[model samples]
Target: MATKTKITIQDIAEKLNITASTVSRALNNNPRISEETRKAVLKAAKQLNYQPNNIAAALRNGKSHIIGVIVPTADRTFFASVVRGIEEIANKLNYKVIICQTYDSYEKEVQTIDALLSARVDGIIASIGKNTENFSHYKKVLASGLPLVLFDRTTDQLDVSQVGINDYLASYKIVEHLIKEGCTRIAHFTSPKKISIFRERLRGYTDALQDNGIPFDENLVISSNLQLEGGRQSMEKLFEAGELPDAIFSASDYGAMGAMQVLKERGVAIPDRVALAGFSNEPFTSFTDPPLTTVDQLSLTMGNITAELFFEQFKLKDKKFVPQRTVLMPEIIIRKSSLKKG
Candidate 1:
């Protein structure tokens, strides 16, 4: 490869027939500098492809102008929308965003966090992995004195800013909706219990059943990964168990889709013989055969709020780590999938 030219302020200054300090002032848009000088320096800098070293600038002011974002998987529409929201604000603030996917692995989540720390990111926004039972990786972020905010999937054990929907209440409302549809036995297809969100949903499901005089049956609940295949397997097992639930409440839209496929394969009618509801109104949910009745977690708004929370913390300049929690109420989008009554 040919040697690439390294352009500096001095080179721009030489090209403009001005001092390096004058070039720096112009490039920084210093108020003392004339507008003509600023335009000329910008034109020269752009022509030379001069990239400012944020690392060197960070040494002076301790800001890398970079933000790290971690998500379970970008394949899901909800996470992609969340990332878009984060980038919307990040781009406006002139900060670069580095995205990392954990694939719901605890080890990968830790590795991603460490890598972001090594990159000297000014702040980090993450939704913890499903398998993340221990939050030591986040504790390290707290110890390092960096701005950290968790969204969607967060833990109360961690003293940090967070933004997420009320999963428990959302699940409760979904169960009640199913009950209103005349579903006596509501089967719950859930993710792992290690995560707080999943646990809360389960609590909501059982509580809703109990409050309505319906018994919480352990056999009706199946714990699975938040995947389509997992949902299918869970539905199959529920099938093999003999008695069918009048309605199914899935923790994820993907899982609900899989269950729907299984039920259809078995000649079971949706919202007729069996109704379906799911969490996180993913894009595919709306376009499903009968469309899915699901909860809108407001993922994009959650991301925006999380980013603003980080900015708030950064502005307050409080490094002591006070927990700031923001919870959003989830809305259920009633659709044909669960509208059994009408």
Candidate 2:
């Protein structure tokens, strides 16, 4: 059997009775090409089954026209929403996205970054992994002169553009809401990891308590991975240690749900016995028995803004670039779980 002949721009140009250079410019959507010519070129290329050589084009243009997006996990709604937002903007700019999941592992995060860099993506947008304490790998990205944008789980150690919700204020709003619902002894669930978001949430919890004239109790603060199982274990230990709180404000919705499960099993009434609130407003929060109160991180908006920021980096590439931080305000979703009063 004879090998199939590969189609090229020259073939499209020959069919259209135009120059191959004009065909190339039209295919690239170059502004210099007239709309009518571009349309004819595209129609002819499609009829001829022309396949674009992205690699060759990248080599000629010195850009891959691809962006790498790193996240802790895509299973969660928050990350998925953000990635969708990123894609919406990226596709409009004729750019493609390569998504990598770290699964909250530091080693995996580092390896993912290296892989993205090796792939020669134009830039990277990432949310730092939970266990990523070392900023060396992220710094390496900067050292290579690649644009980096961090979202949600970002650190100040790297002077890179970042986009995220105001975690501190979000936590504060939730805790303050619980206090307004007559919650006095509130327990906080957070990760022990040095992740900045968790730290900010913790600060918010503490400050809210102090500002509301409620004494902060170290014993009421439980540090863990903030996963469902961690929330269960933390609640169990708190009960075992006789540290029952009047209210619970977890940094993550999963943790709050875990505690809710245990509370229900133990015959403890929500809001009546223990007001519960959490962050991130996971979808399941509303389906729970009493419905959960949570903070909305504006995940979709964060994703769109992150992608926009990534594109903005290209504008400043030729100049002295200063990193910009975009912080989105959070919304508190009040529900039966934390609404004890009118």
Candidate 3:
């Protein structure tokens, strides 16, 4: 192993036959330094690949210039898009992002939050995990006077700024659409209703049926983990009972895809014998056999808005900035999967 030589501002000053203070001011582009001198210093610094010590700069500025994000899983398409949106806004503001995944575990979610706080992030944007019931950990973060914003899977119990789609209304609309397509026997595939998003969506599904003069059948609703295999197994059970629904409204695209595969194997023709609709217009939705008719949650916009909300709170502490809970309307993408009536 060879040792690498350390380069310093003094070296550049000595090489340029200029004082260290002049070199520093020029490198920083201080107004006192001439443009020509600043450009020369910048070019030299770039040629040397000089890297500033951000840690020292952060300490001096009393902020880390970094935003932390905690999500259930980074691999999911929705979360990945949200992260990209957050990164875009943060980059524009000369900030960086640190991301952590909870894997749907409440304990891991708390641990990630603690680690982010210890890292001294300027602010945090998070979507609570599936297993999260107690929000004391989040309350602790708020108590510490750090700016925090929740998105996607936020709780109404807590009075925090949030950005997400109107899950309840979106679900209601999708179910109503299925009803209008002449689907009398409709089933719902969703996770447990303990979480706010799932609860609201389930309510919407049931409400739409009741309001439209359709009897709400508990037997038609299947509670499953928001996973592909769960969807497959649940659909298999529904078939085994000899009461398969003519249509299904799934809470997630992954689950709907799984159900579609199982239904196709059993000779059930989509939009003919059975129809399917899902939430979160994931990329794979378009590539599916008939293209999924799903809800577009606008994950990227939600991420950008969440980041902007955090920054707003940080910048306008004394101006009575009201905590905003923004609920963006979801768009229903009508494709072959749910287009039953021409």
Per-model clash counts, in order, read 0, 0, 0
TM-score for each candidate, following the candidate numbering = 0.90, 0.86, 0.86
Give the winner by lDDT: 2
- Winner on lDDT between 2 and 3 is 2
Q: Give the Cα-based TM-score of candidate 1 against the true structure.
A: 0.90
lDDT by residue (159-222, candidate 1, tens digit) is 8888889999999999999999999989999876578889889999999999999988999999
The sequence of per-residue lDDT tens digits that candidate 3 reaches over residues 1-342 is: 975466677777776778888888896678999998888788777777777665555666678889889999999999999999988888999889999999999999999888888777887899999899999999888888888899999998777899999999999999999999999889999897488899889999999999999999888888888688988977897898896789999999988998999999988999788899999999999999889989999999998998889889989754766889999999989889987886
Each model's lDDT comes to 0.90, 0.91, 0.88
Give the Å error, residue 274, model 1.
Answer: 0.9
lDDT-wise, the better of 1 and 2 is 2
Worst 10 residues of 3 by lDDT: 52-61
In the predicted model 1, the residue pairs found to clash are none
Best by TM-score: 1
